[model samples]
Target: MSRPRTLTDWQALAARLTPQLQGNAFINDDFVPAVSGETFECLNPATGERLAKVASCDGADAEIAVRHARAVFKRGGWSRMAPVERKGVLLRLADLMERHQDELALLDTLDMGKPITSALDDVAGAIGSMRHQAESIDKLYGEVAPTGEQVLGLVLREPLGVVASIVPWNFPLMMTAWKVAPALAAGNSVILKPSEKSPLSALRLAALAREAGLPSGVFQVLPGFGHTVGRALALSMDVECLAFTGSTTVGKQLMQYAGQSNLKRVFLECGGKSPNIVFADCADLDRVAESAAAAIFYNQGEVCIAGSRLLVENSIRDAFVAKVVAAAERMQPGDPLDPTSFMGAMVDSTQHERVMGYIRKGIDEGAVLRAGGEDVAGPGLFIRPVVFDGVTPEMVIGREEIFGPVLSVFGFETEEEALALANDSDFGLAAGLWSQDIGRIMRMTHRLESGQVFVNNWAGGDQSMPFGGVKQSGNGRDKSHHSLAEYTQLKSVWIALS
Candidate 1:
């Protein structure tokens, strides 16, 4: 479906569909304020305008939500539902999501400052994730282990009771669905705590889940700071499993919380400073350059797996840098509601300041700024696509995950140097290498330390592929059949007949 582009057009659309302007934490199929009864303003980064007041939940709210989810799981209303029945509800939820894509997209755009086009893609991905998990629910099979002649052994996967989903703000609804769908498909009740920067879509999702026949307390949304509700969920004894997608620092803290509390199963998909390499023998330099720019600039570089470090072979270093710089020039800050807007504002003032600090560090480290080093002055929190050359591995910009639209360029003469430079980071979430040589591709594929490597492309994957990272980038997969196992526990049943 087509949507309005201009601000005036969007204002008219908003008047007709005011879409829960103010939202509260969703629990037991209803919306309610926190026990503290405090609220915070959700601002539009594009215009710095107050969109709505969101509930500021704390440890008190977390206690109530966890207990309710535990009760629901014990009651067998949802946890004991047949696989096919659970699949049906998830499918219906996807359908309703499709029906309300416009509203959801707008909410995401307003809440997170993502381009409307990007927000639409996020909604589509969220729907796809739910449907994919739904279809895989009943098809998943248990195992029959070999045993002695008189003994039979069977291994079954069972739900882990209550699960907590803590997702980041970059892909709000999609990330939530990636965790929620698989956990729910495994017959577990979920308590989702979305990033405080963007929690509107999660609240909306809970309402849709209830409408699609999800039993009370099966799915809940808590909107608050990570230190409060998120930490509470991590420390809860009743939450058997916790799935989190956010910063590496917070991921480590959650792991500690799990140990300090009930020692819950923790699955984390954390930060990345992914590398994008370009070889001299590449057939299409223009396409590679365009992809390189898109890789780092897309979504204001808020993506966890963004290719922020660009390594080009010395043979094509100058030419590739020029092409990438020109492409970066085209991505400028624009109104997120406008469909044609290619780039949007940062999520908030704090993130905006953080990106600026990185840009300054790059300049201070003697890296030459090829393009866009300053902020776009206006009512919104917008930064230009900053590209820096002459960056060294020891430089702060090269070593840190700036988490913004800032690219660091490096030149390597040999394949060995490129491999060394790419693997020099503490993160191993993802990496992108562009080379047509089959032997080179094979060599890099084997040697790269990252979890997911993209050959001749940037960060790209579907729900069918397993997605996760290693090392400081964190552990456990997010998508595909492997992810379903994260939420389920294995039980071995042995039978003997004499």
Candidate 2:
């Protein structure tokens, strides 16, 4: 069957909807422009075409957003609502999200160059995350301390007022839902700053939230460069909490800003140099090879937790590398709108060039290019998936977070050496171990210094488990009851008997 031609149709659909800047920032229960009249253009990464004009909010606008959020929180618009009522609103929001899945998916694909199929899945995941939080809210309970005296002591969780959540470009819509749903479920207003590279879905989400009856000022979308709007959010005193998912460098800067400003709670899920360790004892070599390729190439490898470093036991290193290289060769970079296309363009030209440069550096540094080591010339930012074998731990390709469809394979003879190689990097975001021995799995899981350790698989976490990283990968967690603490403050109530 022929592939359907739908890119132009999707673009037209996006053109029909009013752009983000056209609608004012949702603040104080109304839509209004920023204190500044500045604006920025959203670029379609696939074609470098102008997608839409978005608000270029400055510090003044951020101040207005935070103040409005504070007002709404104090007024009890969302915070005072019963848990069931809030759940109903969030559930309705999820339903509304489902209703507009096609539009949201199309916008996401056009703006971000993600596969249309993946974009649709992201919409579903976003809805699922929202509903998950809604259901989890009622089960959230405070703690009680046992006391010998007649006095009673109780601990309660309260909203942390306004939270500044900065989401990344790769999974813009789903990440925004991951941050906002839990914050709203915990009774905190949120000011979301999506990556300027991909703000279309976030703006659409803001509109949907309003349509679903979210109180004004309870949710706001600020679309601007990281230097202006993101800086404002990181340093805002009224934003009592800050949650970020991006690079460790920026995460550190935001941490410093938070320390200098309000000393607010900060949650970060930063970069990764995750290891996908393969052992000779593995059950299925073909499945392992396929999963490894998918692990590094999925979403064009923009994943923060991507298993970029492949540690293969020396016994089967040659064969495994051959299999992985063959699998990667089968995957091709094509127009994201093409349903059969397995890989899309990089988020932008700069990222495209960066990935290509890394490939060149790998060659220059003596790593063997097993497959795909060049850029595909095109109007859009596209690079073929690259794989490098015989990579040492000190090599740039093995140590750095490429954030592209590139894989570095390292060979180790002993299990201890595999663990050493995996834990060599400063990042500890996510790692996977492929071994048949249960004792080896347990030993590796305990030794690997990563936030998430997957055994015989890769990237299998739901909204229920805590997701975050250690070391330079950043701190705090997302997705689960633990996330509520990031958006909430604990208070202790003490009563004395006379």
lDDT of 2 at 266: 90
For residues 71-151, what per-residue lDDT tens digits would candidate 1 score against the true structure? 999999888899999999999999999999888888888888888889989999999999999999999999989888898
Per-model C-alpha RMSD: 1.2, 2.3
Instruction: Give the clashing residue pairs of candidate 2, or none.
Output: none
Write the residue-wise lDDT of candidate 2 on 19-38 in tens digits.
53343555565656667888
Window of ten residues with lowest summed lDDT in model 2:
17-26
Model 2's TM-score against the true structure = 0.96
Candidate 1, after superposition: displacement of residue 285 in Å?
0.4
What lDDT does candidate 2 reach at residue 151? 84
Displacement of the residue 200 alpha carbon in candidate 2, Å = 0.7
Candidate 1: C-alpha lDDT: 0.92
